[model samples]
Target chain A: MSRIILYTRFNRFWHWTQALLILLLAVTGFEVRGTFRIFGYLRAVNLHHGLSLALMTLVLFAAFWHLTTGEWRQYLPTRVFLKEMAAFYLTGIFRGAPHPVRKERTAKLNPLQRLAYLGFKVLIIPVQFTTGALYFFYPNLNAHAWPAGFLWGVSTLHVLGAFGLLAFLVGHVYLTTTGHTPLANLKAMLVGYEEDA
Target chain B: MTNMTSPSGPIRPPRPGRFIQALAGLMVLFLPVLATQPPPGPAHGAYGRVRAERNRDVTADHTRFKVLQGPFKDGDGSAVTRACLTCHVKAADQVMATRHWNWRPAATDRKGYGKSTHLVNNFCISTLGGNQEACSRCHAGYGMTDRTFDFTKAENVDCLVCHDTTGDYEKVKGGYPNPAVPLAEIAQKVGRTSNQTCGVCHFFGGGADATKHGDLDDTLLKAPRSLDVHLSRDGAAMSCTDCHGARSHEVAGPDYGAPADRREQPRFAGEAVSRMACTACHTATPHASFVLNRHYRKVACQTCHIPAYARGGLASNLSWTWSTAGRLKGGRPYEDKDANGLVTYNTIHGDMVWAKNVKPEYVFYDGSMDFTLLTDPLPATRPVVLNPLHGSYADPDARIWPFKRHDGDQPFDPVQNRLVAPWTAGPKGSGAYWGDYDWDTAIRLGMEKAGLPYSGKFGFVKTSMWWPITHMVAPKEQALACGECHSRQGRLARVKGFYLPGRDRAPGLDFLGWGLVLLTFCATLVHGASRVLASRSRRNP
Candidate 1:
């Protein structure tokens, strides 16, 4: 077994912050959509707005850091070990088989992780931001030719995007338990170091 | 010109008050002594009372004006109007040009629109027949017993009816001031219009207090804060004229000509348009919650602000059935009262239903309305709207408004397929409905007067009249909550053509979403359990 620094201080901070923000945003957003009423109607709306702003600000700062430090290259998709990694999770992991992929100092994400993260950044996040901004500026969209049901259409898409993100979160959390040990990936994320074999 | 003589006889010359002038001079000489004195104590009540009276909004007191002081002669109100016209030359002309004078809007191309002409309502039907003499008591002018009463005569205008500070002033038949009203005293006490002045006619419209418009009634005269935030003495303490400002005698209320949804921001420093709209004082986004403010585009402020109307003790007339009239007991006309003492049945008015604290019906209104005239054909269906408001969900200018829907079953001419105006009040043996208690005679004579052909056969057709509720705004705490319209069976459930979040859902979407979540949960559980079992076997080996 070998120990290495897999995450920097800023990376650890951004990951936990983004995770908490996403969880809070989901709770408040679902409440605003009338799914539940834990925070009440007005309070839910206020919290959702505030959390969305925080998430957006953190995302911008992370983007700037990734570009400046060239850390964004870590998420680049590769075909090597892609099928083996899928097979390891599907059957081999239950039979005490070794993982096909290894964590290196240069490459932290597997092919599957790269693809899923790419889809989340390009599709789910964009959809949420675009639809949410449209809803915020709805009263100003009083053009004569605009359809009456425009806001409803935007809201429906926004809700669908939220469900997609929620499903991704469930899968992502479960995958963290598939490291060398059950709590290995969680401890590494907490301490900014990974122990790999 | 012959009627232009002053009925208040002649203005008397004022005598000099030498005693009052000498007292004022003596006080001025002792001004320094008074300045050194301490503030008046509670025991010196007269000084405090005089100081409080001095802090009023009035620019000039009518009592001090030389023109108003009179030992008036009273035969007709024209004498009092003539005295007023002496100094205010253009006042009568401006008064004559208003809807208050003509009972209709200024020239519109839309046919059958005015109350004085072809317009008809479910309550008290029409004044076109010989019923003008009875209805003219509410007219702004005097001697309007018939349509032939001259409109050009400025002397016919009665200014005291609207400006009288003395609540004692009343109008008798023929729109003339009651002879016992002490007209000279009221004329001298004239000031800006108040809730009492406007309520005198508006509150008692369909017959008595709280009979016509549900939101307007005697309870507003000295309203408590819970009833109305603006007019309540304990709240803003505003008078009626504060909002309905008169610009050249054209008072600002809801103009039927304009669109209902006013998208303008709050009034600026010197804005030319002085509308009596909620947006005139409040911006469209007045709520602190941005979600609630978003509803301002489609729903009116009144829809949420006024949860219910006709509040405060008085019950509003909800329905009237003229078919049940002419019922007599012991060979004499009688009346029946409900448990609340409201009239349920009257020989003259027929069956009546009254309700208090009524929840208003919701409808999309664009402000303009289509009226059913005498020449217009009646619909085959009953409960036809007499003045159907024009709007729809797709109309951009339309907003969902609250209304008090009054139902009625009034006289109709089946052969002509039109509504007929029956003379309900006149001298005995004059073929009036109230006089002879004969519908046949009343219909025949009334048709002759209205210049309409009648079938000699009349039936009562069910109809409805919609009155917009824009008054009696409750406190902000009383405003409707989000769940009230966002729930499954909430207020906006009946409002269609739009999908609400909590009130509506797609079963297919919900099923798919929950199924995906469940599958993910089961898959993770199986994977975790298998991994744990494998690790246990490895350790044992």
Candidate 2:
């Protein structure tokens, strides 16, 4: 086995920072929902706003790095080995099966991984952003043009999206352990290096 | 160059100590003189206030003038008023038209019957005939003796009852002025009516002090800042007329109590007169919280700001049952007092129940009330709504309002199928209910005077009258909390207009949410366990 550069310095930094922000948002969001008592509703609202703003700033920097470094192409998904990767995860992986696709700088994410990451960026994040932004700006939006139940509907959508994101997080964490060794894929994301499996 | 102070040799900065020392010496010499001067009088602050000197806008002085000097003490108040009118002619006509002088109003807003005119109350019932003199004691006029008392006669208007600055003046059952009050002195000292001056009648209206309104009483005369920040002598020092502006003798605000609608609360300067409202001084949006401010569109200012009424240790009557008024002891007229020391039973009036720190009943009113008047047919089986709140949650102009709902019983004509007028006041021989203790004779005289046909058979009808509350404002910190209206036990829990989040929930939604969360956790645990078992089986094989 040989080690190679799979994650860049900026990429690793963005990943960890994004993880920390999502954690803060989830805790504060649940508090606002009357699930637990941490900071009061008012303080929790303020902190959620601040964290969201920070996450937006981080996203801007990460988007620029991805475009400039040509790493944006790593997430572009393909049909190659898509069936084999799904089958391996469903059954063969529990029987100690081999990975259907290889990981390198050129193709960092396998086909299924590429599909999940792309869908999350284009679909789930945008829904969360739109719903969250609308809640914060509802005051500025007057009542004449909107329906009476618009606010309640928006709130429900945001909470549902949060649950979806939490499920994705659980799956993502478990899949990272499916590399050649349990800690190999995690070490690559942490230290910017991956060993051939 | 050496004369240039040996450059760079211990650069010492010039000190201001000598100047300071000289200033201190001068201060010591002037200290005694400065101490002798009086310190400035207290400036206005949150602690309270002192009344500002009255600003008299008019330039005329009647006391020194030659035209006002003759026949001042002669005949009745009319003679004095005739002299007063020589200079100010239109004043009597304006005073005569007001609800104060007439003891009646032509129209109450856009509603059908006037509030004080033909519409009867659950307390003391109708002031139609025999009760005229008893009820008219609070009327700003003199000699409204019977139905025959002329409304056209300007002499009947008592200007001094309101304008007198002496505060000793009293108007009794016959609308007769207290003979002790010197008419000449009252005529001379007539000015803006003090709170003490108005309370002479208003505070003592409805047969006693604080009996009619839960928010008003003698307690407001020297109210502290905590009791009333606006009217307190130690707070804003505002007079009644300051907030309730007067135009052509009409006071700007709700005549009975609360403003009809939000628009009536504040009128643009010089615009047509309307009910004076709290939002006039405190703008509709006064709170820093956008959530609380946004509530102005749907909830009245008083509902949140006035956490309680009758908070000044003054009791306000909540109900009066006229059916119980006939109780007597040993054939003599009797009386009893409630636990709160309010009238429970009396020979003339009936049972009265009162309360303090009273929680107001919430309702959505759009200003109009279906006032039960003499002319309207009475509801037989249902509780007669003397004046019910007229709007619902669906009304755009309507909002949740606080009300002091007085509930009791009044006599109704079973034959005429309408409300009967019962004479209630005067000396016993004059045929009042108090004098004769005979509802038959009293109703006959009352119906005859009011020109309404008596049924000859009368029964007590249960009724409820509402007074919208706009006073007894509590401090900002004491205002109703967010949870007060948002929780299950909140003030608005029983309000029927709209759905509330914390106070209301659909059981289906709750069950569905719990079910979905459980399914997710169970699915994860089951799938993970099955995968682990299969991995071990493969390893064993």
Candidate 3:
């Protein structure tokens, strides 16, 4: 076994910070959505607004980093080893079969990882940001005679996007354990090094 | 900027100092906006300053002026009114044109929708027929016993009733000062309308103290800050004319117009919008919390600020059953008092109910109101809305307003399908309900006098009247908390047509969303347990 640097200092920082921000936002956002309450309605709204601003700033910084450092390419989808990766998770994992992919410096993510991360960033993130922004500026738009039920439609989409993000979080956390060791991926994200085969 | 290092190497982060500097610069740019926010809580000083700057004492002392220093006889209020008109020539015309003097809108105003003409209220049914003499006690004019009293006469406009500074100045029957009252002494001290002067009529509307408007009462004369922040000496210490804007004898208030929604900010002196609204002095968005500020678009300021009506010690008339009138004890009219010593039953009026600190009924009001006219056929619905406020959640200009809803059962002609106004008070020989104890004679006289057809048949019908509550604002600490209307069984439980977060939820969405979360959790648990078991077996083998 050998260890290699899987994540850089800023990459790890962004990952952890983004995770914390998303978690806090989910709590406040769900509270505002009439889910189980923690902070009062007023406080929940304020915290959600403030957290969204922070997340937006982080997203811009992460976008700049991805573009400048050419890290965005790491999430580009490919069909190579995709079927093998699905097979490994479906049945081979319990039978002690070998993994279809390996950790490397030049190619860090496997085919399945590429597709999942790409979908999250490209589809879910954009939907969330767009819907959240429209929801925030809804009162300003009230003067304009928008179609009736426009706000209702926007609110429904925002709520659905929140549920989708929550489901993604559950799956993402669980899949992290499917690495060579159960805690291996989590540790790599934290300390920026992975114990690889 | 591109990195000078090789592509294979990890990218170097921008210097931390530069990021911190940028953040500091953003905060500095935001400081001015943060400072511009008006300091929270009540805006008492802001309104006070505006009032003080405008209401400067510039008039010559009335005591020194020979025109006012008169040995006017008691009960001679017309003499003082005549003297007032000597200097202010057009004052009578201004007052005469107002609804206060006419007691009815111009005949052109929606076909004369007013109390003395077409409109009918639950309390003191109507002043038509022979009852006009008794009801005219509260009228602004003198000796207006019937329709014959001249409206063009300048001396009939009693200016002292509103402008009198002396607390002793009283309007007896026929809008004349009390015979024993020192009219000469009171005339010299007249300056401006106080809570005492306005309360003489407004507080005693519907025939008794605190019977008409649930927010107004004699308790406001010496109110504490908790009772009324505007009128209380402990607060801004404002008088009736402060917000009402007494310009050219035209007292601007709810009588003029009640716009349910106003987006305009607070106005300074000389920018009088002629509105007796909280927004006249306070901003539309006056809360420190942004969530509360957002509510300004839909919820009226009075809904939260004035949590309840009739908060003063005096109870307001909540319900009246005129059908129960004419109940006499031993062939004589009598009154029945409740355990609290409040008059619950009266032979002249009816069975009545009064409440203090009453929670207001919520309703969407867009400012326009539809009154049941004297000629309009009665609606099929029981407890018919007398003055139905025109609004709904669908109306973008509407806001949820607080109201004092007075319910009653009064005589209506079932055959004609119309409300019958009864002449409530007069001499025994006159066709008055109070004197003759005859509903038939009173109804016939009232209908004939108003020139409206009434069937010989008469029966009682339930009705309700809505009075908008915009007074008795409590201190900031007493404003309703968020939970008051955010819970399932909250203050706004009966208020419909809008979605409230905690009080409302789409059960289908909740079920579907929760079901998915539960399935995901269970799947994770099963998947983890199987993997653990599989790993254990491999190690054991």
Candidate 4:
């Protein structure tokens, strides 16, 4: 096996922490909406706020680390093989087809995977974070400073980001079950190891 | 074809089984992620439970009291009184007090009071009749079946009508059919009904008995302007007790007299006390006019409209009355006599004054309105003596005169102590002071001077004065003005866009809401486009 280092310890830490925070956010978000009460509302809200702050800090750290290491290049999108990747996920994956692009030590994610992850990071995450931040600090902001319309717009955008995240989660859960084995992907996330092709 | 067959083989599809396996793994991981995460706790649980229980109680109570008590007409043209009371028997008193009990035929005979002789006709009853099932569905209560029930007993409207007892009833007693239970047991078995119960009654087409004074349809009820105070369909619904609970049952008489004893008759108990009613839904400032201008706070509604006591009697209209004779400590007469062979004794009767003394800064009335008496106050005359022991008597006329008073310093303005205005500008013998009030002119002038909209109906002369008086009586003229109360009816007529007389204008939030939507859309578009462009660049690079 060509033992080329792909994910560093800090990278893995950020990834896992981010994933946990996102999960916590989803749980607390839904609880706030009153779908089902798992944690008491007050506790859920407290935890939600705490986790949101942690997520923000982690994001800041990750951004700094990425900028410092020039690793933000990992998320640079490419049109090459994008259509093929989409097709593979939609249809070919169900028919036992091979992946159009493969992961290597230097190129850890395929073109489509990179694009999707970049979209989530740059677009969805930022939108949610900014909107959420604005909402929390809304009272502190000068009421007449921002156009009243803008505040409303930001709130709507935040809600849309929430919906986008939800959609991603659904697809993500489905894809997780489509791993080499039912437990394979899950084991990898927990133990920080995956099957080498 | 030859090249395809030559070197590389056919493209292989992804393994479906592997994908399924990965998905299963993800779900498994997700499950633990949820499990390890603590569940939402007590506050959320309590809120949920209270919300649910409230809904149940309200629904149960509404169905029993308002919906089922009908002479519901089925499609087959037959009347059917549903058996809602078969399950709930305790809501009888609640149903009776509500406007629903009198939802029968309007008294068509016009001879009783000067108005139409009939007690007000419920729109539902007038249009749908007691036999219509569709009408009965919303007007639920006891005695819904046509042939099986008596309308007189009002047996259809029973207790547990608005109260939902699904969980509590099951917990307290084994089942709902247990009749050999104590009142306390039944009471304990019940839980508080939510705002949902109120919604059930207050909802679209449900409580819209258009013939009634307070009837509001769904369109009016759901208008944006009505959001703060109006009952929402899905949001918090207020309960009957929320507005009615300031008083309880033990209080007697509509006069608001002091309770005989706290153990026997509690003060503020429910027996048609309007002040108690006002305090229930309103806090911060209870009296509408008095809250804004504190001068007229001493006068209560019961003081002017004499309350008639009816322990086990039928309903009666309020009339004016004045006490004539003063009773001694032993319930005997006290007398005073004068030296000129004239006798003057202690008499309780006083002159009728239309407007009570209030601060001039707060007074809303124009000076020209007529102050004619509608009904003469009772007890016209009494014998009096200046000195009772000396046996000198005098004749005294004790007629109650309804006269208008202006806002001036009490016991200071010469006009305040006397019935007549000292200064008169009208021509002599013109009868201008004696003429009936020109209410429309007065109201228009008053509203214009106050900088308020005068778009409401001056339908009749009595109402013109009455409306203004009611407005003046409200403590806060700014928040609870004559226009606010009258505007409900006026708005339906499309009169001035739901303007309340005294309230500071509410900031419209619709534009803000729309603006938010557009902003969110643009943000999402930018975010998605940026991701797409980044992905393309990476692919090329």
For candidate 1, give the DockQ. Answer: 0.17
Candidate 1 local accuracy as lDDT? 0.78
Task: Tell me, per candidate, how large a share of the native contacts it keeps.
Answer: 0.27, 0.08, 0.14, 0.00
Local accuracy by lDDT, each model:
0.78, 0.70, 0.78, 0.36
C-alpha root-mean-square deviation, each candidate = 19.7, 12.6, 5.0, 26.3
Which residue segments of model 2 deviate by more than 4 Å? Answer: A1-197, B1-76, B104-112, B255-275, B329-351, B379-381, B426-431, B436-441, B522-541
Candidate numbers sorted by TM-score from highest down: 3, 1, 2, 4
Q: How do the predictions measure up, each by TM-score?
A: 0.83, 0.76, 0.87, 0.31
Interface RMSD per candidate (angstroms): 26.5, 18.7, 5.1, 19.6
Off by over 4 Å in 4: A1-5, A33-45, A144-150, B1-541
Q: Which is the winner by TM-score between candidate 3 and candidate 4?
A: 3
TM-score of chain A of each: 0.95, 0.95, 0.96, 0.82
What tens-digit string does per-residue lDDT give for candidate 1 at B71-174?
56664688888888887899999989887787776765355366578677878888887677778778788888866778779999989888888898888888
Candidate 3: how many backbone clashes? 0
Off by over 4 Å in 1: B1-75, B86-90, B108-112, B255-258, B261-273, B283-295, B323-353, B379-382, B426-431, B434-438, B499-507, B529-541
TM-score of chain A of 4: 0.82
Model 4 C-alpha lDDT versus the unseen true structure:
0.36
Q: Please give, for residues B281-379, the per-residue lDDT of candidate 4 as tens digits.
A: 343243332222221222222122211111111111111112222234354334443453222433221111211122111112221122211121212
